[model samples]
Target: MKNEIIIFSGIEPGKKGAGNLVYFFLDRLKINYVEFKLHFNKTPDGFLIRQLKNFVPRNLSKSLYYSFYRFFFKSSENIINRKVILFHPQSIGLELSINLIRNNFVYIYVFDNFLFCRKSYNYIDRNKSCLLCLKDKDAYLKYKCDFFPVKHNPHKYDDFLLTISNNLSRVHFLTQNRNQSNLLYQKFGPIPNLTQIGMMVDMEDVVFNGKKTVKKYDFLYHNTLIEAKGIFYFLSIAKLLRNYSFIVPFSLKEVRNLIPDFEDFENVDFLSIKWNTGLKEILINCQVVINPSLWSAPVEGALLKSIKFNGCVAVVTTEYSFQSEIPSNVVIKLPDNLVEASKILNDVIDSEKIRINYKNEAKKWFDLYSKDIDISFDKFIQEEFN
Candidate 1:
C-alpha cells in the first residue's frame, strides 16, 4: 500500500516565497500532492461586492455561494483515505473546504500568525478593524458586519495546529497579548501528538563569492514602500548618508502613491524593478541588505539570497529571534535605531577579510542544507508525520 499525503494551500503556484517553498519541497519529496488554485473575481465591481459582503447579512451571501461551490466541487470520497494538511485558514472559502473534509484525514492548521492579526503589513486581513472577530459577535459586526464565515466559527474545525517555530508561536501569543500555548493547553488540554515544524530554506541557490568589491553605502533597505515595511525609516537613513545610494525596486508610480513625494529623497536613486524578476539581481549588485520589519518572520529567503550573492544583510532588532542559518560574515543584526545600523553597515563594507570569512561560512551552511532533498523528505515523513 502506498502512503499518500494531500496538502492544500490557498496560494497560487509560481508565486515567490511561501508558495514557491511549498511547490519546491513537495516536488523534492516526490510526495503525491495536488495544488488547488483559489480564484477570486477580479473586477472593480468585485471590490464593491467584497465591501458589501463585509457589512451585510452574512447568511444571505454565504448560503448562495456555499451551496453553489459545494455542488460544483464536492470533496472526493477517496480523499478520506489520504493524509491531509491545510496550510492556512484565513480564507473563508478555503475554510469551507476544510469543513467539508475535516473528518477524512489528519487535519493540520499551519499558522503564520499574521493570518489572525488585524494589523499585519501584508493585506491579508479580511476584517480590517475588528480585533475580536473570533470571540465576540459584536466585534465581528464592527468589522466584518455579516460575512458568512463570520457567522460560522471556522477556528473550531481545525484539528491540529502547526507553526514555523517557537518565535512564530510567540507572535501569535503576543498578537492577542495572551499566552496562546497555554490557551491551547486549556482548551485541548495537551496535544503532545501535534507536530511543530520549522520553516526550511532551500540552500541550493546560495553560492559564496569571496570578498567582492561592495558598493559603498552607509545603510541599505529593500522592500515595498508600504507603511508597514517602514520605508520612511529607510528614507530618513538615506538622508543621513548623503553619499549612500538607496536602491528601491518600485516604479515611480507605485512609490508616489505609497509614499508622499517619494522621489524627493536627495541621495536615493530609484531602481525600477518588480520584485518577481528583480529581487535577486538587485541584491547581487548591492552592498548591504536591510530588513527593518517591526514585526515579521525571519525573512530567510532574502537574507540567504543576499549572502549567497555576495551581499551582507542587516535585520532590525526585535524580540523575534531567528537562528543564524547564514554565514556570520554576511549577516549583521542592526540596532533598532537607524544610526547604529548605518555604522554597522559602514564597518562591514570596509572590511574585506570579514566579507571573505562570511563567504566561506555561507558555502558550508548551504551545502549542509542542500543535502539530498529526497532523503530529507523521507526523514521528515517518517519522523514528523508518521
Candidate 2:
C-alpha cells in the first residue's frame, strides 16, 4: 500500500509559530496527505449561532470544536492504517489527542511545554523559567497558570497530562530543544519514542532582496506581547540608551497596557505591522533585534528571522535554554542580570565597529544551522515508518 499521512493542528496556515511551522513543513513534504485545521470558527455559522458565539465560554467552545473534528475523522472512510502527524495538538483539545492515539500510530510535535504545563510557556507568575509542574502534580493549580479560560478544577487539567504520559508508548514525541526533552524525560521517567529534532526555520521565507535596506531603527523589539518574552527587559535597555531609535511592531493600546508608560519614551516607535509583509521590512532595516526571553524558550521564530539578516545583530539572553541551540559565534549574548545586560547593550550600541564585525561573521553559521534543520526533518520522515 502507498504511504498516506494525516496532519492535525489548531490554527490556520501562515499564522502563529505552530501554524507557520505546519505550513512550511507541508509545502516541503512530497507526499499524499490530508490536513485538519481545527479553529474556533470551524463551527456552523448562522444568525443564531453568531449571536450565541459571543456568549459561548472559551472552554465549552474548545470541547465542541474538538468533539466535532474527532467524530468527522473517526467516521471518514479509508482512514485505517495511515500514519497520523499531530502538530500543536494541545490546541485541538485533550479528548481528540486521546482519540487519535486509540485509532492510529501518532507522532506529536511539541513546540512548547504544553503537555506538562498549564500555561504552555513554562513561565510562572510572570517571574522566571520553572519546571516545578513536572515534580508536583498540583504546581500548575497552585500557581494558577491556566492559559485557557477553564474553571479552577485541578483534576480537569491533570487528566490531560496524565493521558499523554500513560500512552507514551503509542505516540511518538518530538521537541526542538534538548532541555525541553530532558524536562519531559524527568517527568515521564523515560519515553523510548521521544526524539529531539533540531530547530528549523524556512530560509525561503527569510530571503532578502539583493538591494540593501537602509538602516532606519537602531534597535527592534518584535517579540511576543507576553511579558515573559522580555518586554520589560527591552524597555530597560531602551531607557538606558535613550538616544538610539527603537521600533516595536505591535499595537499601541496593547503595548501601552503591558508597559503603562511605554509612550513616554520618545526613542521607541510602536508600529502595528503584519507578520509576513510589513515586519519583514522593519527586520531588514533594523540594526539590532532584541529577544531577551526570561523563560527557557525553545528557539523563538523572531530570533531565527533576525539572525538571517547580515546587517542585523540579534541580542538574546544567555541564561535561557534556547541559547544552547545556537552557536555563540553567530549572535551577541546578553546576561540575565537586568543592570548588567543594559550596560552591555549600551556599550555595544556606542561601538559601531563591534556591530559591523559581528554582523559580518554570522552568515556561515546561519547557513550551517539551516542545513541541519533540513537534515533533521529528512530523518524524522524516514523514522516515522520504523
Candidate 3:
C-alpha cells in the first residue's frame, strides 16, 4: 500500500498568505491528502483551551488534543502507513507540544528562524540575521527566543528534541530551512539529514497580463509596519528622498500619528492592499517593491509577483533566504544604516538609466529563482515514494 500523507499546519487552508503556498503545492501534485489546522478554531482548539494546556499534566493536553483531532478528522482516503507533514507550527505562537509520532513517517517544513528568533523576525541589532544564540548564552533571554510553550512550560524543548532523535520503525524528515539549518550546525556541530532548498512560487499567479508597466512611484514598502519589517528604515529613506513618492497601505493621517515627522512629506501616499489582486496590481504598477525586512524571509509572495510584473526591483536586506543564490544584479540589498540607505534611494530616484536597467533585471530574477512550483512538489513526492 502507498504511504498516506497527512498535512498539519496552524495556518488555515483557505487563507491567502504565505502559509497557503503549502496548499498550492499540494494542489499542483494532484495527490490525495488530509489537512488538519492548529489555528482557526473557537472550541476545543481555541485560545482558552491552549492556555489551559499549561495547567494540565505534562503530555496530557497534547495527547488529548491529538486523539480528539485524529478521531474527528482522520483521512477518508484508505492508503496505509501514513506520512505526516508539519509546516510552520511555531509561526502563530502555537506548538503541538509533542513530536511523538508512534507509527508513521513525519516531515517538517521550516520557513523562519523559529528556534533562534523568538519573534520569528530572524534578525539581530545591525539589521542582520546574526546567529547570536549559537554564540551568546544569554541570547534566548535577550531575544525571548521562539514561540514554543503556547501558554508557558506546556511542552519542554528537550522532550521535543528527544522525540525527533528517537525511532522505532518510524522516520522523521525535514524541508530545507537554510537559516535555521545553519544555526542547527553551530548548535549540534553538524546534522547528517539536512537539505537546503530555495522557495518557489507559481509563475501563473504573478505573470504579466500584457498591460503597460509604467512605474508610478520611486519606492513602495508594505506589510506589517513594525520595527522587525524595517519599516522605520524605509521611512527614514523616504524622508531623505524628496523627489520620490513612497506608498504604503495605511492612511496618511494614521501614518502621521504613528510617525509625526512624515506628516510634512507630501510624497507619501497610503492605500491598504487587503486583497491579493490589489497587492498584485500595486506591485505590477510600482517601480520598486521592497520588504526591507530585518527578518531573513525564506520566500515572499510580493517579491515573486513584483518580479513577474517586469518593472519592479526587489530591494531587500542581505539575508540568506532573500539574497542567497539570487543574482546580485537581480535583487538589490538594503544598506545597514539609514544614512546609506537614504543615499542609495536618492541615487535611484535621480538616475533614470539606473532605474531602467534595474527594472529590466526583474524577469531574469523571476526565471532563475521562482519560475516553477513543480520542482518543489516533485521532491516531496519522491521523498514519500522512497
The local distance difference test score of each candidate is 0.46, 0.66, 0.55
For model 1, residues 49-105, the per-residue Cα lDDT tens digits are: 556556654334534444344333434444554555554333324444444344344
Query: What is the clash tally of candidate 1?
Result: 0
Clashes of each: 0, 0, 1
Q: RMSD of model 2, in Å?
A: 4.9
lDDT of 3 at 305: 56
lDDT of 3 by residue, 1-386 (tens): 34335666645544544445665655644552433323221124567657766577433564455445544433334423566666654422232424424345555566565544445565656466655655664566765664322323325544454455554235333444455466556555545555454455444554434444344766788555555666666776777777788888666654554466754567777765443435566665666777676666666655665556645464655556654545666766656777777776666667778767777786665665553445655665555544
Of the two candidates 1 and 2, the one with more favorable lDDT, higher being better, is 2
Rate residue 217 of model 3 by lDDT: 67
Question: For candidate 1, what is the lDDT?
Answer: 0.46
TM-score list, all predictions = 0.63, 0.82, 0.73
Q: Give the top-scoring candidate (lDDT).
A: 2
Top TM-score prediction, candidate number: 2
Error of 3 at 265 (Å): 3.7
Candidate with the larger TM-score of 2 and 3 = 2
- The candidate with the higher TM-score, 1 or 3, is 3
Clashes of 2: 0
Ranking by TM-score: 2, 3, 1
Could you tell me the lDDT of residue 105 within candidate 3? 58
